[model samples]
Target: MPNGCDDQLPNRLARGGYSMRVRFQVQGLLLVLGILLSGIALAAKAPVLGEQLEYTLKFRGLVTGFVEMNIAKMTMAVEQEMGRVDENPAIVTDLHLTTEPYRKAEMIYPVRLHYRSWLDADKLHPLIAVKSLKTREEKEELLWFDHSQGEAYHYQSGELQAGSNSRPPKNLQGITALSDEQWENLLQAHQVSIGGIEALDYISFLHRLRSMPLKSGKQINFSTFNGKELNAYLVKVDQERLVRAGWNRPAFRVRMWEVDSESGRKGDDMVDLWLSDDNERLLLRFYAERAFGAMEGILETGRPTGGKDEGFSEATRSSLETYLGF
Candidate 1:
């Protein structure tokens, strides 16, 4: 992840392959959708189906990327080994991310990534996550979550579709590309075991977190799948604060990190986040210590699904300026 796009995964995901990617090329898109998008029906503690949060991506001090979330009526088609399931009355989230040319760093052309997620209407479990990416490189990933059977399905685009710049490591033993006649057989869905893990894809993790009671000094731990590996994560409620966050609402200062419970050694990546202190629990701001300096996401503008822009309070803007050391 360090070499690739600094995707919206746990800050640790940055240690992967490529300079242009910090996140999963496919589910980095999927992760952001889960991490930031919300559903409308479940109540205020979780994201409403019609709510959308727009964010600005900053690296060091540059506004290099933009990401936005929009949740609408759930109407996407999803299929699994079991069969097709009707997602009517489901919750759907769409995410879009774009980055400007980092010409000075050899990252010339801009990049765009798109992701979609569908969740069950009542339980809010992830049904499927789909990703599409295009830049100097082309990659796609799709995820199927069948929690009922405790299984996960994954797919990564074959190298044939890989951009001239990216040659994904071969998972086919010593074989790389297969003949066209054998292509369909070669490109098969890979499976990861998640039978007992309470795993949430990147996007759905936030929803799960929102549903928790983050009382002061409480610690929450869970397992999450970042497509490739299933890792454990910890979210602790460090304390509560009275910052206005530009609005008059109170906020909670929380700490998040990865942990190896067996060894008890902490992870290198760390995240400090601010969430609304009320039932809404919006993720107001976060600063992640990643390989490439601090990756910051600030709320720029947002609205409920089908609603108009709900402007950010100037105080929130000023707080960001001060927090970023502007």
Candidate 2:
């Protein structure tokens, strides 16, 4: 009986130790999982605020303009007629494109265009977009997108003469304050409606590209509303190594083209874009053939580190400029 009691004592001790081990293992796993989740949340929120990208615009291998892209935090508040207010945390992106003064390309038609897009931070859907242009004449246009109703409202301030055309209209202080009847009257000719699930404008489309999962050999399709009409695009993605501004990096080469709005047939206007294959997904290079000639935009200061190059021989550049009447 003494020997049997001693055996049961060891068995009980062994069971107690095993139970403690199992508890410790589970606690360790939970701690690690919590840490991983926290890390992911921080990473997702860190790089989004106050980020800016500057690009140098080149036409026929000569620096002609500059482009600036900025992202910032915003709050979108919309008040309905019944005193109900919808406030949403939002992200606002601003893109400014300006031609260098007295540059050969600017001699013909100078351009100073500013665009802003307000988007829902969580869903990445656009809420409003503003287009301000200063070419021969200055004009400003605003587009307020209502995805809930699948409609977009357009407002324009005619031509802002000379004095009052400096800054954009204050946010939510203008068109959003109008009533439904006022908006309906304002939407007579400028009413733009979604033809598909959703439509993005120029600025929102660029922001969407950054948030998308771009993998090699992937094809993405979407529609864009360019103030007047709905344009569909099919984009093809491929991974490639690109060299620019003395920096060579792996990039996602995206080729985009338009499709027929009605038939979905392939159309014209092919544009090529290169984005860094990193967490930031920077726009390293942009190439589009315009009516004037081939226009290109490269990162002003390349990723990681960068150095500048003229990208064309002096004689070749001179000859091309002369031919293009620059």
Candidate 3:
């Protein structure tokens, strides 16, 4: 009996050593360490605010292992809030990309988001205009839209409509007709003009950080226009190279670490954004974990062809300036 018990003990010990639980523990530990190291590296490169920046944004979406959708080109401009500007405004956003099908059709489109600000009573009001230009058979269809008072206005050909409307009046025919809801949906799906308000918030946060004195580990909370709060940790501050997602636009380089609250469900929901070591005026890169996998955006800058400057008004500029301290 004693010999039988001793023999069984060796087999039990061998089985326990190779258990699935043990293997899982090892993998989980490694994942945690990797995440920690990433945070540490980011902290070491945090930048101070108020630095001039220029960079480009490149967008690539992978549909399969070999299929990719490459956007043409994207550009961004960043400047410190001059007086009372609260948000970092996007001076220009030019999108140039071509979509290639697996075997057939390919299409190219140009999208632009231009902004200009002036001065208001005690705040800096920003006016953003989005334009999309598509050419077909020697005919160019130019479309424009603006957002105001929780509604968007569409101006194309020679007609205008207000509110959550999409199509212009029947009387205003032959013009490119698009509703606010439709345009918004298209941009969101294609991830174009995705950074409009978010980019503004990023700039405002940078300005605030720039004005503050340097510290080892400083944390700040920022709320977006949509009421989402993001927490930023100031790990390191100084000058560094910052890269963003676009085609050929200039991007500001800065050092910063921000953790944004997850919008949807709970489990492992977070969006992490990092600026380069230099304190330019734009976001360098952002990483988020979605239900499927991890996704990221890198800024690429480029030059724009000659076009009209349909930007913000002087009165709106005054309002934004007063509000943001530009």
Candidate 4:
């Protein structure tokens, strides 16, 4: 529970178990999603369905786990329901983090975390988000956002015996209007306010960052709810670098920090990321510093489904090259 990123995972990571640390580290890569910005627009397009990426999580130079991200087409029913509010179809994003436990740690501890979000294709706002996590226990969480009605709902199933191994729920639950009891609980928990500041869930926030116009020295302000408290964050586009992910690729280095909503001061939870400097905006590398050792995420393989508008146009590429003095 350090820094209020998540309730369970961080506490488990703090135990200093190698396997748990690695799993926590892998999830940490995605935890950075809670620490990004909102607003401002560019000509960036949303990630196309079928885009797949795989990453290797390392702790102290040792491979400990793997993270996979994918974009899948949404069901027609779900798309139509969202279409009632907006004309755009919903994009479904999936994230899977599994431990590659070393030193026979798998037998001792096995961990897997799966997260999925349904986001507006045009607005990039989350319609629904769900995650199933497995460590020594299994738990599931679901968050539903009704922008039209200006209501948000959070449901935690506590613990389930067969939840983690099961697939994400196909049926959209909690789509109804917030009941009186639900409203009272949300107000007490302060997960998010209906008409308050725009707060995206973890997955939508990450995709929102991809849609932003990323230029070096740029800073953006945003807020997100981590299935717990709603916290503000700031992200700075630090610089561009040539990162080696299978090959040398131009990438933008971005750093994220938590900001106090009242004081507007920065917190200690920091995350660093390198995203490919192109329309695709692939995550090239990431590193997070923990109270114990640090965890690093390296792109092992990236396979885009070759959709339209994949990378920078020739003119844009040349312009960037001239600007960077390449």
Candidate 5:
């Protein structure tokens, strides 16, 4: 439902490397957590809350030696209600991703999310849509454009005669057709970072942490409107053994720092992400180490051949099943 915390950032990252820095510090530490956990799971115990979830993203780096570049599997469903300020309010979240690579060929993206909270205009609106089907064939040659605030529209095939078409004729532009400041410097050198579903509340630790003095393995020092200054650390892994899928799942080790922002031209890379203390803190995996060789591929199966009417609604499926307690 967007509001994942706002600020929108994330496009994609991990490719080519050069800069490096890491520091650590720990003491006192008070608050920095963001809550968003649910409850209700007692069939055998171990499920405070859950509506519907599914994930499968395997990415092994190294183009020359360690292959496996793609494999995206996703299925999400969350709903909860009663919200003016709070009290368990989470609605709409139905994602279905199916990507493949390992060798080549495979793509499926079915996303539908809707969230609204006005409370008389307090502001909270998130609506994402990507569902087009007509038996494919590039869906008439493809043609959708949003670029962020163009609103939203996608075709990629044919049949979208508004005023006889003004600009929706790219066909299937690649490299995102560049030019948005060169696609935002190629999405900040692929370190990509677009609102991460709205930051999901920084990774919810039960919410309530905004002090900011820097503790728990401190390092801080941030900057990234393009100024680039990075250098952040703070670890606390252990959210139910981090669930698990592959690679054993248990890393968010945190404790990474790298600074160089006086205008030296180098700071488009920063990898260190792990957050899975269960309860749906979910992020659970991220590790990159590949400077230039680059050449990997992995993705075995994927479905959603056409697009199931692009779903969502029943009051956002009962508010994501009561904030994810499916």
Candidate 6:
């Protein structure tokens, strides 16, 4: 996310025509969102708390950033004005995303983000999501998702309130004249439907993708509510191949695109994902074509912090440690 929440880089903005500012946001979201890593075999049906997954983000083959995602069960006490207790089983995800320069330096990197998402443990629907980013300036975003009502609310705050001071469409400039796509985004902005398994953010979508039975040469379309706008993604399952990660084994190369994909259509600007084929199904490689170039990432480290081996193989666990040499 950019400091100027308005710099929606890859929000359907033409690829080659991206300004330097949009380029930064595109890289931020590409790395921040899909930096999500999950297993080939999810132990029970839901992720247990205290699970940590880390990935090394790269651009054009160079390590540029790192993303760490952690999950934990949170209990929210609904107090009566009289201080009564009402507990709920909720899971919260804390994500820390930062670039290489920030990691190696005392100063801040141009693109750095820290965000957390709280979801209903049983349903995997989000309750609240907050994100903070530091670029030319620092900005914070808050989103609340009401699945029952099928609506998501967004609030922006920061030292520099870039897009926060937006006026209604009638008073705002360029209301009558608009592109069809832009109009669609505007109309679906705040009001959205959560019917069935739709309205998922990319992080939630990644988790949901794991359970889906994606057979070879199959494609599935799903709706995603990206806080800023509503969009759809077409996920295509390509042939399987052996990709080297913690181990050299068979994996599925999945392609995803946010476009109007019709039958037998592969849309432009795709995101590529590789997941291990075995039951220990771990995320292996992630790649997405960005405005500047292709943004790439790989699983760097993963382990059950609870001193229990759910199913990760010895080779997979050991190989990750060797790859993270100091």
User: Best TM-score goes to which candidate?
Assistant: 4
Clashes of 5: 47
lDDT for 234 (candidate 3): 30
Summarize candidate 5's per-residue lDDT along 242-267 as a digit string, tens digits: 22223233323332223453543334
Root-mean-square deviation (CA) per prediction = 11.0, 26.2, 20.3, 11.9, 24.2, 12.7
The TM-score ranking, best first, is 4, 2, 1, 6, 3, 5
Tens digits of per-residue lDDT for model 1, 1-326: 01123334333333344334532332233243333312122224645656666665544311122212121111211222121235334456667766643332223234567766666656666767666666666766666676777877666666443333332224321222234333232332456678877777766666666666666677778777666667787777755443322433346666777889588667876677777666777776655533333444555443223433334323334435656564
User: Which ranges of candidate 6 are over 4 A from the true structure?
Assistant: 1-44, 61-88, 100-109, 158-197, 261-266, 302-326
- Ten-residue stretch with the least lDDT total in model 2: 34-43
Residue 109 in model 5: shift from native, Å? 13
Better of 2 and 6 by TM-score: 2
Q: Report residue 244 deviation for candidate 5 (angstroms).
A: 1.7
lDDT of each: 0.51, 0.53, 0.29, 0.56, 0.26, 0.49
Question: What is candidate 2's lDDT per residue for 35-112, written digit by digit as tens?
Answer: 100111111121265667666554431122121111111111221211111476566666666654434324334556
Provide the lDDT at 171 for model 1. Answer: 37
Question: What TM value does model 6 have?
Answer: 0.60
lDDT of 5 at 42: 15
- lDDT, candidate 6, 1-326, per-residue tens: 11111223234234455345354654454443543322232232444456566665543211222212111111111112111111334566666666533332112124567666655566665666556666666665555666666666655552324344432233111312334433333321243555565577655666566655555687777776666666777788764664433434557778887765245444677777887665444666676644443454666565223432233222223324545552
TM-score for each of the candidates: 0.62, 0.64, 0.33, 0.65, 0.21, 0.60
Q: Give the Cα-based TM-score of candidate 4 against the true structure.
A: 0.65
Segments of candidate 3 deviating more than 4 angstroms: 1-62, 66-72, 78-216, 226-268, 279-282, 292-295, 299-326
Per lDDT, the best of the predicted structures is: 4
Comparison by TM-score, 4 against 5, better one: 4
Worst 10 residues of 5 by lDDT: 22-31
Report the C-alpha lDDT of model 4 over 1-326, residue by residue, as the tens digit.
01112234334544666565555644554454323212222335576667776665544312221211121111111122332223547777777766543323333345577676788887788887666677777766667776766666666653333433332223353332334442222211223565766878867777788777877778988877676667788888865554332435557777888898899989887888787777777677776655443455666564233323324322233434544575
| Model 4 bad stretches (over 4 Å) | 1-43, 61-88, 100-105, 159-171, 174-191, 244-247, 302-326
